[model samples]
Each structure stands twice: as C-alpha cells, then as structure tokens.
Target: MRFATYLHDGVTHAGVVGDDGLHALPDGATVLGLVRNGLPTALAQGTRALRSPAVPIERVRLLPPLDPPTVRDFVAFEEHVEGVVASVGDGAGVVPEWYEAPTFYFTNPYALVGAHDDVPVPPGSRLFDFELEVAAVIGHDGTSLTPAEARDAIFGYTILNDWSARDLQRREMKVDLGPAKGKDSATTLGPWLVTADELEPFRDGDGFLAPAMRVSVNGREIGHDLLSNMGWPFEDLVSYASRGTWVRAGDVLGSGTCGNGGCLAELWGRGRPVPALAPGDVVEMTVEGLGTIRNTVVAGVDLPPVAPARPRPRKRAR
Candidate 1:
C-alpha cells in the first residue's frame, strides 16, 4: 500500500492512497506513530480505517510520507561517487573502503518538504543543484542488525532530492570534514511512501530491488539510472548504519545520488557553477513504480539588511 502525510483544511493527516483516493488514518495520528507501533499492527489498524467514506486523497496536500526522527543519507551509489571524485580530480573507480563499509551523513528531519511544493532558492545562493535519490524508511528498532535481518526491518521506500548549495559546500569541505551547511538547508522528499510488500514484484526478478529512476528540468530529461547500479545495496547500508546505533521506525536512509549526471555540477564542470534556479523553473524527478515529485523554483524574498554600527570616538591616551 502507498502511504502519505498530507495537509487538509490546515491540518496534517496520515493516510493510505487507494484507487478511489486517500483513506485517512485516525485523528491526531501520524505515519511515524503507526510505524513505531509496529508495521503489522499498524497496517492492520490503518487498513481498516482506510475504508471510511469521508477520507479522499484529492482534498489533501501531500507531505513527506513519514515523519522521521532522524534521516541518514548514504553514498551507496558508486556511479555518483566516481562522478563526483572525477569532477574534483580525486581519481577514478570506486573508493575500495566505500564498498567494505557504508558512508552516510545526517539531514535535518525538519527541513523536509513534500512533493509539488515550491523549493525556495536561498537568498545569496547562486549555485543550487538537485540530486535524484531513493530513501528507505526504517520499521523495526534495533542496533547492530545483520544484513539479512536489516532487509526485513525496512518499512518502505520513497523518492528524495538532496538539494545542494555548491558554493557553501566548497568552502566548508576545504576543512576536509563536512558537507554540512551546504546540505542542511533543505531536503525534498515524498509524493508517497510505498510499502515493502508492494515492491516485492520488482525485487523478484533478481532477488534485489532495482527500480528505474530518472530526473528532468523544465521538461528536458537530464539524468537516469537503475537502482541495480548501486555499489552498496540497501541491506548493506542498513547493516552498517545500525552497527552501533539504534535505528527505529520513521528513521530514514537515503541511497545517495544516482548516476547519469543527475546534477549540473557533474554534467558540466563546476567551472562557472550552474545557473541559479529562478521562479517558474520546474524540476521533476521520478522512479519506476513510484511517482514523480515536481517542484518549482521560486526566488526567496530578501530580508532587509541590518545597518552598520556608528564608529565610536577614540579615547584620549594617558
């Protein structure tokens, strides 16, 4: 079943998407609460509630499908890594260590925005870019889960765009440590959260999940890749992320960026930096079996600058 968190009549709601429309969950409850309450039990209760006549998908504004307590985005796609490394002249081929272990970073849960929302270009930012990715939502809570078990712990998957500010990133990475400020501003997620059971057919072909993914800007297809191309799969990433940390329901794990030059930074050398997105520029990202998330870029309103303090008179020397 596909699930979503949406705003209707100024209130946020959790519901399951159906052929007719959305079937709303109970009042004051959220997708996170359902997951934390255990997938089986939650599904049982939610499934029943979805049959109500009052709930309809057309009347709501879709938000991120789940409200994660924490979000960990992993660089599990070697194509993206290699492309980035090549862009920075950091050598070719996958870094061997990346395969042996999963590498990830944290994103603020509060920064998440729903599909179709306007993504504001931060003031003073001239180098904004978009990354196409797939993220997993955790269901079972555990620490140090094995790869096999980790697969079962996943609740579902959703699309994510790790919007980046190249200028800010470059300055910070010079310290050789973080991708923080550059990435923290915003992370776009959702259209719907698809359940694990719904994805079983796609996984059946090769006993692994390999969805076709693509992205476009202003109706021009720019990048595409298959989930099969990932160097480290979701299960491996889950195992690594859970090694010493507890992963609970509503926690998110992203599959980093995909290949085929999803962002302009990879397609064109960052020599001049990609043009800043302006109001009315539509960006669309899609994954097979899942849906498309379309966002329009809007120029943010500039805040008034603070006035400079007046200079004080020099004190007399004694």
Candidate 2:
C-alpha cells in the first residue's frame, strides 16, 4: 500500500493512499511512526482510525513520505563511478576497496524538500545536477545484520534525487575529504513511499528488483535505466551500512546515482555539455513501483558579500 505525509486545509496529516482518496491516520501520526512500530502489520492495525472524510489526493500538498531519520547514500553503480572518475581527468580508476565493499557518504537530512517543492540553487553554485536513484527506508532496529535480515528490515521504497552542486563537490573531493557542503545543499524525496509487500513480485529469487528508472528536465527525457544495473543489491548495502552499528527505523539508504545518463555528469562524460539548472527549470524523476517526484529550481537567497580580510601584522620578535 502507498502512504504519504501531506497538508490539507492548512493542517498537516499522514495517510494511506487508496483509489478513492487518502485514508488519514490519527492526528500527528506520521509515516515515521509507522516505521518505528513496524510496517505493514502496524500500518494495517492503524487503519482502523481512518480520520473522517478521506481527502482527495489532488487537494492536498505532499511532503516527504517519511520524516527522515538519517540519510546514507551509497555508490553502488560502477558505471556511475567511472563517468565521474573520467570527468575530473584525475586518472583514478575505481579503487580496489570500492569493489571489496559498498562505499557511501552521509548527507545532511535537514535540507530535504518534498515533491513539487522549488529548490533554491545555493549562492555561487555553478554546476547544478540531479541524481536519479531509489532509496529503501529502514523499518526495524538491528546491528550488524545478515543480508537476509537486512532485506527484511526494508519497510518501503522511494525515489531519491541527490541534488548536487558539482563545483562545490569538486572543491571538497580534491581534499580527499568531503562532499559535505556540496551535497548537503539539498536532497529531494517523495511523490510518496510504497511498502515492500507491494513490491515483492518484482524482487526476483536473487533479491533484486529490476525497476525501470528515469529522469526528465522541463518535460524532456534525459536518462533511463533498470534498477538491476546496480553492482550491489539494497540488502548488501544495508548489511554493509549496519556493520557493528545500529540501524534504527526511519533511516534512509539510497541506491546512489544510476549510470545510464541519470546524472548530467554522465552526459558530460559522453561529451554532452548540458547547461546547469537555471532559475525555473523543472526536474522530474521516477522509479518503477516507486512514484514520481518533480521539483523546480528557484532563485536562491542572495546574501550580502563577505568583508575583506585584514592584513597580517608585521613580525615583532627579535
């Protein structure tokens, strides 16, 4: 079943998406609450409330399906890594350690925007890009879980658009340290979350879902691929992320950027010089089974310039 967090008549609500409309959960009960209580089972039990008249989906404003706990985005696509490695002309091949385990970076959770929200390009951002990927929301508590256990912990899936500022990212990555200021600028999730039970048929015996994914800019298709292209499965990523660490409900794990030109960097690697996002450009992404999320680029906060640095004092010691 599908679920969403939304605002209607100036009030925020959480509910299950049905053909008729959205069946509301009790006041203040969020999808995050459903994850903490255990998905499907707890959600089914909670449906008994069905807060008064179901609101038509179109009448309400959608928010990120879950109030994100923490976000960890993993680089699981070799195709994507190769494109980026080539773009920089660093002569760095995919590292040996990368092949040995799932590699990832933590991103800020506070900058999240929901479907259709306009993201302001941060000041001085020159190379704006969108990453098309899928994310699994953790529903249970576990530490150092087995792959099978990790697979079971997945509550649902949603599309993740890890909006990136290439210029800022390049500056930090050169130090071999961070994607922080670059990545933390913004991250988009939604259109809503679909429970795992709804996607069981798509997961083959190998435990991978071969969902068709794509992204579009201003109504023009830019990239497409199958989720099966990932070098690693979501379960492998979860097991790796939970190594000797606690993964609580509400944590999000992304499939990283899918290569088939899902990101502008990949297009550039192939000699397509697409311009960065200008004000008012709309970007949309969709993953099979998981719904589509569309966001618009908006004007940024233009703050006053910084003061000039003072000259250093002359040496005085003798």
Candidate 3:
C-alpha cells in the first residue's frame, strides 16, 4: 500500500493512496500514530476506507510520511563513500570500521519536507548540493534485535533528499568530527510511503531488493545505480542500530546516498563540473518500488557576512 500524509481544508491527515483519491485512516489519525500503534492493523482498516469519500490525491499538499521522533542516516554504500573521499581528496578508502558496523548520525527531525516543497538555498552556501537516498520507517519498537527480527520491524520506505552545503561540510569535516552546520539546513522525504508488503515482489530469494535508483536535476538525469550493491543492507543497518538501544516506532533510518555520483560533489570529482542548486531549480529522484520526490530550490534566511579567518597562535613551550 502507498500511504501519505497530506493537508486538506487547513487540516493534516494520514491515509492510503488510491487510484481515485486518498482513503482516510479511521483508527489511526496520522502516519506516526499508525506506526506506534500497529501498522498492519491500521493498514488493514485503512483499506476499507477506500469506499468512503476521498479527496483526490493530487489536490492535497503532502507532508513527510511521519513526524519521526528521531532520524538516523546510515552510510551503507561503499561507492558513495569512495566517491566523496575521492572528490574531497580525503586520501583514504572505505574504512575497516565502516565494514564492521553500520555507522549513523542523528539529524534534526524538524528540518523535514515533502514532495514539491521549496527548499531554501542556505545563505552563503554557494556550494549547495543534494544526496539521493531512501528512508525506512520503523513500525514496531525493539532492542538488540537480530537481522531477521529487524526485517519485521520495518513499516515502509520513502525517498530522501539530504540537502547539503559542500563548502561548510568540507571546512567542518576537517575538524575530524561528523557533519554539523554543513547538514543542519533541511531534508526532503516522501511524495508517498510504500509499505514493505508492496515491495515484496521485487525481493529475491536472498531477500535483497535490486532496484534501479536515479536522480535528475531540471528533468535531466545525472546519476543512476542499483540498490542491491550496498555493502550493508537496510536489514543489517536496522539490526546493528538496535543493538543495546531501543529502535522505536516513528524512528526513521536513511540509506545514505546510493552511488558514486548521487551527489554533485561526486560528479565534480569525476570532472563533471555540475553546478549547485539555484533558485527555481527542481531536483527529483526515483527509486524502484518506492516512488519519486521532487523539490524546488529557493533562497533561505540570509546570514551576516562571514568573518575572516583569525591568525594561528604561536606554539606554546611545555
């Protein structure tokens, strides 16, 4: 089932997406509510609402599938890491630690967006960029779950566009810590959430999904890849994340950028010279079994002039 959260008549609602329109969810009010309660039960009930009066899906303004309590983005693709390190001249290959565990970082949930929304180009971010990926929404809560069990906890999947400020990211990453000011701006998810059941047909005997993923800017295709190539699968990432901690409902996990050229940085590394997003530029991504997410760029809050770098202090004698 394709589920979506949308605004209508000044009210926000969650429902099942249908050919004619959207079917209201009776027992569960919102996507998050359904995830926390019981996604399967809520979905079953939602199917019956197909007969009820539904507003045409196209007319309503969509919101992020859920208001997640926490959003964790994991680096699962070695191709993406290799491309980034190459582009930035990081002088290192995929680390051994990356292969040992699925490392992730928590992002600001308040920075969420939906399809067709206007994304702001952060002030002073002349090197703005986008990362194409997918996000998994947790349906049931669990801790220290095995990979098999983790699969059952997954509620659905959706497209994720992690907006980036490349210049800021480079300057901050030199500190050897994780991305902060570089990535706090915003992230786009949705258009619609495709439930796990809906994607089962694409899974192979090994339970892996081999779907073609692609990204485009202003209707021109830039990068494409297959989801099955990730070094760490979504199941592994979820199970690893659940270790010694609770993976609760409405906690979202993102499959970091899919391939070598999913972002402009990678393209630039490969000598493509792709320009950064500008006002009115539309960026779109499509993943098999999921859907597409398209957004427009706009100017955001302006910042004060950047201060010049301070002089380095002389070494102190011990």
Candidate 4:
C-alpha cells in the first residue's frame, strides 16, 4: 500500500493511497506514526480506516511523507563515484577504502521539501544540481543489526533528490570536512511511500531492486539507470549505518546517486557541460514503482554574511 501525508482544507493529514482516492487515517494518524508501529500493525490499522470516505488525491497538496529524524545518504554507486571523481579533476579516481564499506554522510533533516515544491538556488551558489536516488525509511529502532535484520527494519521506499550547490561543496571540502551549507539547503522526498512488499517484484535476487530510475530537466530527459547498479545493496547500507548507533522510525537511509548520469556533476565530469539549474527550471525524478517527484528551481534571497572567526595566536608546546 502507498501512504501519504497531505494538506486538505488547510489541515495536514496522513492517509492511505488507493484507487478511490486518499483514505484518511483515524485519530490524526501520521505516516511517521505508521512506520514507527511497523508494517503489520500499520497495514491492519490502514485496512480498517479505508472503510471511511476518501478525499480526491488531486485535490489535496502532498507533503513529504514524513519529517525524518535524520537523513543518512550513502555513496553506494561506483559508476557515480567514478564519473564525479573524474569531474573533480587532478584525474582522481575512486579510493580503495570506498570498496571496503558503504560510506554515508548526514544531511539536514529540517531542510526537507515535498515532491512538488519549489526549491530555491541556495545563496551564493551557481552550480546547482539534482541527484537521482532512492531511499528507505526505517520502520523500527535498531542498532548493530544484521543485514537481514536491517532489511526487515525498512518500512517503505521513496524517490530522493539530494539537491546540491556544487560550488559551495567544493570550497568547503577543501578543508576535508563537509557538504554542509552546500547541501543543507534542501532535500526532496516524496510523491508518497510504497510498502516493501510493493517493490518485491523488482528485487534482483539477494541484491538491490532493479527499478528503472530516470531524471529530467524541464521536459528533457537527462539520465537513466537501474536501481540494481548500486555498488552496495540497501541492506548493507542500512546495516553499516546502524553500526554502534540506533536508526529509529522516521530516520531515512538514501541509496545514493545512481550511475549513468544521475547528477549534472557526473555528466559534467564526463564533459557534457550541462548548465546548472536556474530559476524556473523544473526537475523531475522518477523511479519505477516508487513514483515521480517534481520541483521547480527558484531564485534565492541574499542574506548578510556573518564574520569569520579571527585566527588566534599559536604557541608551540614546550
């Protein structure tokens, strides 16, 4: 079943998506609450709730399915790494340690937007890009879980667009630290959430889902790839992320950018020279079975700068 959080008559609600329309869950049930209770319980509750009348799906404005407690995005696609590495120049390539484990970074959870919202060009950014990927929402809390256990912890899947400011990311990482302010502006998750059972038909053996993933600018298709192309599967990404830490309900784990031109940087790295996103440009990403999310780029306002920290006098240890 697909679950959604939406606005109707100036009020926010959580509902189950169905052929008739959007079935509102009782007692102000939220998508986060549903996932927190795990699928079996949520499904049972949702089934009973469907007896109520549904609102027309098109009439309500959709919101991100849930406000994640944390968003952990992993670089699990080798082809994407290879292309982006080449783009960053000095002829750098994927590192050896990258092959040893799934690596991820925490992105701001508060910076999330809905599927159809407008995203602003981050302040002081010119090289804007969109990453095409998939994400799994954690169904329950767990730490140090096995791959199988981690897989079971997933509530559902959704399309993830990791919006980026390439210029800010490059400058900040020079100190070997961040994608911070660069990436903190916005991340998109939605259309809605599809239950794990809904995607089982696309499973590739004991590996990743082989859903067809695509992204476009305005109306032009820029990239396409299969979800099965990831260097490490979702279970590994989740298990690795949970090592020595808890991943609770409403926490999100992204499958990272896909290969074969998932982002403009990878295309630029391959010498395509596609222009960065500009005001009014529309970006739409679609994953087979997961649905599409569209966001229009808008101009950002300039803010006064904060003073940088003054360098302190250094004293050598005696």
Best candidate, lDDT-wise? 4
Clashing pairs in 1: 22-57
Put down candidate 4 lDDT per residue, 176-272, tens digits, no spaces. 7657888889999999999988998998885678999999999999999999999877888889998998999989999999988899989988889
Error of 4 at 206 (Å): 4.8
**Winner on lDDT (2 vs 4):** 4
Q: What's the CA error at residue 166 for candidate 4, in Å?
A: 0.3
Instruction: Mark the regions of model 1 whose C-alpha exceeds 4 Å error after superposition.
Output: 54-58, 88-94, 204-206, 269-276, 301-318
Q: Write the per-residue lDDT of candidate 1 for residues 39-69, one digit (tens) a residue.
A: 7877886688667764565677788888799
- What lDDT does model 3 reach? 0.84
Residue-level lDDT of model 2, residues 197-236, one tens digit each, is: 7777777676788889989999999989888888889989
Model 2 regions more than 4 Å off: 49-52, 88-91, 304-318
Task: Flag clash pairs in model 3.
Answer: none
In model 3, where do residues sit more than 4 Å from their true spots?
A: 306-318
- Residue 285, model 4: lDDT of 94
Please write out the lDDT profile of model 3 over residues 1-318, one tens digit for every residue.
887888878878888888888877774488888777787676776777777788987788889888999999987888888777766547486777888878899888999998878999877888899999888889899999999899988988888888988888888789888787778788998988888888777776666777788999999998998877777778888998999999999889999888857888877766677888888889989999887888999988888977988997787875
- For model 3, what is the error of residue 248's alpha carbon versus the real structure, in angstroms, after optimal superposition? 0.4
List the candidates' TM-scores in order.
Answer: 0.89, 0.92, 0.93, 0.95
Residue 193 lDDT in candidate 2: 84
